[model samples]
Target: MGRVKVLGACPLDCPDACSWVVTVEDGKATGLRGNKDHPVTRGALCVKVNRYLEQVGSPDRLRYPLRRVGPKGSGRFERISWDEALDEIATRLTGIVAGFGAEAIWPFHGTGSLGYLQGLEGYPGRRMFNVLGASHHAATICSVAGGTGLRYTLGTSGGMDPEDFARSKLILLWGTNPLTSGHHLWKFVQDSGAYLVSIDPVRTKTSERCDEHIAPLPGTDAALALGLLHVIVSLGAQDERFIAEHTEGWPEFRDRITEFTPERTAAITGVPQEQIVALGERIARTRPTAIRASQGMQRHAGGGMALRVLACLPGVTGDWAIPGGGLHYSTSGHFRLDDAALVRDDLLPHPVRTLSMTRLGEALLETDDPPVKALFVIGANPVGSNPDQRRAIEGLSRDDLFTVVLEHFATDTVDYADIVLPATMQPEHLDVIAGYGHLYLVWNEPAVEPPGECLSTTETFRRLSHRLGLTEPALYDSDEELARQLLKGHDLDRLRADGFLKIQPGSVPADKLQFVSTRAELAGHDPLPDYTPPADKGDGLVLISAASHYFLNTSFGSNPELRRRAGDSTITLHPDDAAARDITDGAAVLVSNARGAFEAVAEVSDRVRPGVAATTKGRWAKFTDGATVNATIAERDSDYGGGAVFHDNRVEVRPR
Candidate 1:
């Protein structure tokens, strides 16, 4: 028996690139756990990663390359040799390029494979496509809007570490519920000793545990944020000295917030005027106050503006100077890694045409002339995650188009593919990870050989490149060489010895008012936080798509344990709303909008605000006639970032 080595870092979309330890008996992996010696994660494991054994060895896993035996989206396929699959894909794709312009071919991908090497920058796909002048995709689905907003206000999107939460006197969990989505950061929140204030339209698990819960009207977050700023300024709590020294646009920003009196903001936000005043006073009076915004606020129309408004709070009070008092969008310490050096741009012949992942439906179906002739889906399941199920299905169902999916299982997106390429799980690959939420860079070693012909993403690309006749210097190398190249200029000996590397820390400004003077130094847009209201408040009820505690998109929906934990999708409605509609808990109800309708189990809970309905977003599409929660959402996007307006939808629900 030999100690099974756990490779640190796996999963493309996750921020916590945790290290795992494998136990091997007779050359077979028997168990896996977190590497306790890793300082950042500290041996913590999320439920998704804990079930690696089943995921890697499941009988349902895709074990070999398979080509379509029937029509597209038919889920009928016949096993094909790897050589045949690669050769056929390359030949067909090349022909499409020869006929149509490079822009005619769109490669749609998202954050599913966050590893720089496995995805855009590190992968040879971008290089190959660029050389062929193929269409490129702009990976801006989840955090781009929020990232843009932060870049405008803070100069940099990176923020203070989550472990520094212990130094705060007050922490406002604005529109973010970390208990469910970011469990790794919860430890610091729980130990912070600060008063937790949850301000959201729904009463989530994070809100339930907070010292105070402020339920604002949907899309009225900017109004609430402005009202608080007004109160802070009125009380003379603004850090004038810090502002004068660090920031630039104070006078104009101050004048803009004058209109957001507590009374005026309360009317629009559904929060009490007195409560707003008190919260503002507390934020100003607290020795060190922190405001945390999450992706939820960035999912609606004007979402970027909402986040920009919230980012100004820390600046107004000069809270950024405090160790724990600052605006934090993410604590994943990915910026510490020298990504520029790791990204080998010269490997590609030219830049590929790009498309936005958020508007995948539009990009795939609405393109003029030679539309997306072939799609290579890797590390993403847009069929389940993209908004508007009808539109996504229509886009993916191009009759003449060929689709290929590289996956570990038969996901909702796999059914639409013409070919399925078996992919290896995390423990079966050699890789490196730079966690965005933490400062650890992990060296992922192959704990076990890929089972039954499963291949790493790097391997898949290597074979594909070979078939395509790509002769670039970078594309012709092995995975180990790629890793070494990416890790260039670093202390590799140290990383290999510890199995991880923590980037050296740097000096961060301690003066909360630094931005007041250094506003011009920030990265993008207006430095001062700004506020804007939603375009419309429809007569129909407002709908919000939130994540569940048990699943991450549609990826884990099929996991038996997770499925048991999250039995079925249910609509959470306020008692008043449910009663008005004659709906009761456990009753089946039809939720409909202009796009389409679907039946969902009703769970009448006061967790939601009146006139607002809530449901989990990542359930399987087949939950009800291929009915997805996103189907009820329109393509209406935010004015600034064009982010999906999931929170701005209007729908009606009735008993089924």
Candidate 2:
């Protein structure tokens, strides 16, 4: 009867990388809880990660290698040894490279883990393919659009820490549901005792808890920001001193915003003219104000431009000089780490062709020249998460396309695999995890032996590279060695022992102002933030596929307790919209658009405004009654950064 507690971190693709402690008794993990020592996590995990032991010890976890025994898209397989699986994969890939060149082998991956080493696109796993001269993947499935847009406006993405929200006098939560995703940040916002205002198309769970909630039309946030700017400048609230001393091209920006008066913006954003004016005045007058945005805003046609315009609020109001007073889109770029040392792009065999991850369906189905011959996937569920699920799945079902997936569960993507390799859960790997929402970098350590014959992604690829006979000394670095090398800017010893470290923010030139112009300025498009309408427009209703409180992207979509709480997938619409469409509550309704469509039970609610149907992401095809929600989404790229325009989707809903 022996019990021991081991420290670890939740390495999911979350902004708050929570530190945790695992209780192992009799050589088995018995309990898990958040580490009280972690300032950001504050001894509490989200609803999803709280039941992670079930995920780690789930009966359905893949414990062995598998080979297809039935038709594609069917969950049928026969167990195979690691050696046999590796040999077959190596031989097939070898034949592929020899016949069609290394570029033919397209390696697809996503943020299955956020660990510095093990998670985030299966780091070292891609090293093998890179040295093999495989096709280059533009991993912009998420965040890139918003992150890039904000960076262009702010000079750098560095901003106030989430914990610093307590110092603010007013907080604007725009396009973010902090209660579900950024819980720690929400706590600070609450503690600040400031006026909490939420501006989102949906009256989200977080909006429900806010002092005020303002619903704007999807893809129209730029108009909202511009409207605010018009009020701020007209009412003499613009920070004249800061603008004269630190900023560039303020005259053009000011004149340009006058066109976005409350009435004009109201027509665009669907918010009342009076509400827009009131909100704008409140923000301008509020000292030590902060605007915390989400990556979701960038998942639209005009997403990049929206963030760029929104970032200007702080500069106009002089919030950048004050702690916890600037716009906090992400504190990710503030942290320093040796990323080149970790991924080692210098090891690439040669320059390679590029493919867009946002348009996976097109890349898989329409890619030419040497077209993608063989597919190797790791740490991603593209079938469920990627837009145009039907096309993505159709490509996966191709008899010619040899597909492989490395995962811990038999996900929808795994069902179509020619080979399925077992992967270790978070507690079975090593990582130095960073957070976009916090200041601490957490050390993730294994708490128990992995179930079945699972292998870490790095080790699996390292073994495959050996089998393929590519002997670069750099390719064979141990996980510990890799971890130590990537941790140059931070204290390795302190992080290893204490399980967490508070990272200091990066320094930018004060004279440059927080906002740095990217290029030549003309009508807010060049050096200044611009407003661009979405290219796609539907006739009937608007559809937004966003993350539910239960799932973060596609990570923990299968846990029993979590999934039970999440209940079954359904489309939520305002009661008014449902009534107008003659859609009854709990009745099946068909939601469709030009790209594709899906059917879900109606849950009439005001979680989202009228004409907007809201549902969750990460539900696999098997979990859904019909097609996955992503099927209704287009495989479109954003205005900047090649990000997926998930929120830009438009659809019509009616009784099925």
TM-score per candidate, chains pooled: 0.94, 0.97
lDDT of 1 by residue, 1-656 (tens): 56646555655455567766777666677887877887656787777768868877788899999988876667888999898899899888888878876667666765565665665435435655655566767666677677666555655567766667778889998888777776666777778889999988889988989999999977889889899999999999999877887666788788888989999998989899999999999988996887778777777766776766777787778877778887777644334444544445454456555666777788777876667888888877887887777888888888777788888888778888987899887667777777666667777677777888788877787778789887766555676777676777777667766888877533333223222323333434444455556664667688888878777766676778877888777888899999898998999988888887767889999999897899887777754467778788776567555577777788899999
Clashing pairs in 2: none
lDDT of model number 1: 0.74
TM-score of 2: 0.97
lDDT of each: 0.74, 0.83
Off by over 4 Å in 1: 119-124, 331-343, 347-352, 504-528
Tens digits of lDDT, candidate 2, 1-656:
59998889988877898999999997799999999989888899988888889899989899999999999998899999999999999999999889889999888867888776777733547678888989877788888888777666666676677788999999999989888886888778878999999988888888888899999888899889999999988899999997887677788778778889899999998899999999889988889898888888778888877887877788888887788788787778887788888787787868888887778789778887787888887788998789888899888888888898999888888999999999988888887788889888888888788888999888888889899998888789898889888887678988989999998877422235534464424324456566778766757767777787888777777766677888777899899998898988898888887667777889998778876778888776787754778888888888777899888877888898
Models, CA RMSD each: 2.7, 1.9
